[model samples]
Target: MNASSPIGIFDSGIGGLTVAHAVTRLLPNENIIYFGDTAHLPYGDKSSAAIQAYSIKICNVLLQQKCKVILIACNSASAAAYELVKEYVGSKAKVINVIDPVIDYIDHHYRGKTVGLIGTKQTVNSNIYRKKTDALGKDIVLKSLATPLLAPMIEEGFFNNNISESIIYQYLANEELSGIEALILGCTHYPLIKSQIDSFYKENITILDTSEIVAAALKKYLSQSSLLNNLNAYIRHFYVSDYTQSFERSTQIFFGEQIRLEHYPLWE
Candidate 1:
């Protein structure tokens, strides 16, 4: 594995850009190759087999890109397909998902506290976070609100507006988001509304957004496995399964600047 090889990260849609941002902040000198399967924007609504098939398609693209490691940055993709990718990518490249890092963080740092989950319907249904948090012997209460509206809300850059806040309030209407000392922004897109979420809950709530944690975990694994990028070379690649002018415009919130966009016929 070349130290300079780029890391591959994929999401069902543009939300994985959150993960890409963290990787950039954590390993500024390393290259990244990101793929967004935007044709199927919300993985939360798809069945398990559909997610598995879609994940493998993006994984193949990453392999073609010669990525040194792949990050399954989307929660639904991670939940339904990380094991499949790990099995397929076996012994060659590293693959890490967003789940374990959150578990590890809660176990090691948080110790014991109830966690509030705000994610897509699929993630909450899978019970991945709830089971993992409980497995660590932490007396954590799992309260989840499937905020499906958030994906398109952030994608459309609506986080700063009152409409987005109204959506958040509507999503958590029956659930008590005010009480949890710890909140998990289970979707990559949720961090875009972190300030608004914070404003609603106040400052003392410890929000856990795993983009940083996952990036740190990937960095540690790359270092120990001797796959860290070479100090001298850096690069970034952006690929979308479907191209849109709006994508390039919205990417500034995530990617800072629009690099050229490439399209691949994935999930076809």
Candidate 2:
């Protein structure tokens, strides 16, 4: 593949759209192909081995599509399957995950702040955030809550419905997120619930979106590798293990603008 080839990105589900959108905004001239494994959404409950298998499958599919670089846009998959994909990508392609960049961003920007994390059970248990933040020499007081329901709520097209709002409200009610100066939306899928998060963060706490940090990291990698694509070209292709209207609704929620999306199957 040439340097001008499009980058491939994938997530367990619609969560990856956040990363894809961020990369597009930063590198508008480059083309992107995104895959969402909606057939097996909410990877939190699945075993690590299962997630790794799925991640490897997605990487192979993306490579066959002629992608020069791959982004494991899902946090769960990144924690579980990044090494597997890295082997396949080798020197020919680079693989970027969404975690390390945000950790670096928070370490540099908000030193010694109380950082609260909300993600899947697996992500919280992985402690990648805690380890990375501590490595930057900042004493970060990290409190994590396993927001298992948020993914399904958003996936089912219930952003503002009774269940979605209730789940979010319940998580915040008894829990003491008060000392947290900033909250990290640890899961990519959580961005769709941004409105509720913003409205609830009226107590002067800052909510840092991981997508921004991921985009900046992606730019740095492209520049360092001399793979920055700038040509008279622009295109984006979307794929899903199973696509549904609910996926479109979730995309619209995160993108801030509706996109004409074409669905492709990855299981073939």
Candidate 3:
């Protein structure tokens, strides 16, 4: 639990880079080691068991890197594997998930109102948001929509263009999203299009994205635990199970810098 230890963050793919970027901005002195399971990506469509297996593999790599804390930056992975990772990591490192922070944000800010949730099929089908909201006794109506296309579309570089807009409109304009005061961008990849989604709704509804929320949560935890890094030189390492030009492109897009990404193939 030393301050110099890097924070580990992982997602199914480059989507988790959103959280990694936010963490860097909020805690500039903390080193980070991010792993993207690009080979088994789009975990949203996969079964819970499969997601857990992938998550365990990623966490093991993160632990081997000597990370002091682990952040599950993908919604689908968080939904399926947060508890498992938490249990597995135990006291060796803290485990944070993108899902709980957003849920807590909604519970505190949007209580008694209708909140819309959008994520991949596995996440929505898991009914995690509704279950968590209910467990917290938050008196809000939780409406969930399985948006299985946005991640792949964004991965293919369709973001912020006419094609992206058309797909976003088709999903957000659905009847199921009506009457909600706030919409939860359940996927980490969704923040890349946060402005588009906001514009589509004309800023009438609040869009909750996990990047800032999770970053803030991590900062608070680090501060309270006295684990804040004091060094000025921060190192960031990026790894992917499978390497591709598209992932490198998306990493730069989300991280806002051309970073050298390393390949660490987990499956043979």
Model 3 Cα lDDT, one tens digit per residue, 46-145:
8999999999988899999889999999999988999998998899899999988887788789878999999999889989989999888768899989
Determine which window of 10 residues in candidate 3 has minimal summed lDDT.
244-253
After superposition on all C-alphas, the RMSD of every candidate to the true structure, in Å, is: 1.5, 2.1, 1.0
Candidate 2 global TM-score = 0.91
Q: Which one wins on TM-score?
A: 3
> Which structure among the candidates has the greatest lDDT?
3
The alpha-carbon deviation from the true structure for residue 44 of candidate 2, after best TM-score superposition, in angstroms, is 1.7
Off by over 4 Å in 3: none
- Model 1, which residues run further than 4 Å from truth? 176-178
- Residues 34-132 of candidate 2 have per-residue lDDT tens digits of 888878888877888999888888888788878888998988888887888798678767888988888878888788778888889878888888887
TM-score for all predictions? 0.95, 0.91, 0.98
Give residue 112's lDDT in candidate 1 (0 to 100). 57
Task: Give the local distance difference test score of model 3.
Answer: 0.91
Candidate 3 shows a clash count of 0
Ranking by lDDT: 3, 1, 2
In the predicted model 1, the residue pairs found to clash are 3-229
What's the distance in Å from true for residue 123, model 2? 0.8
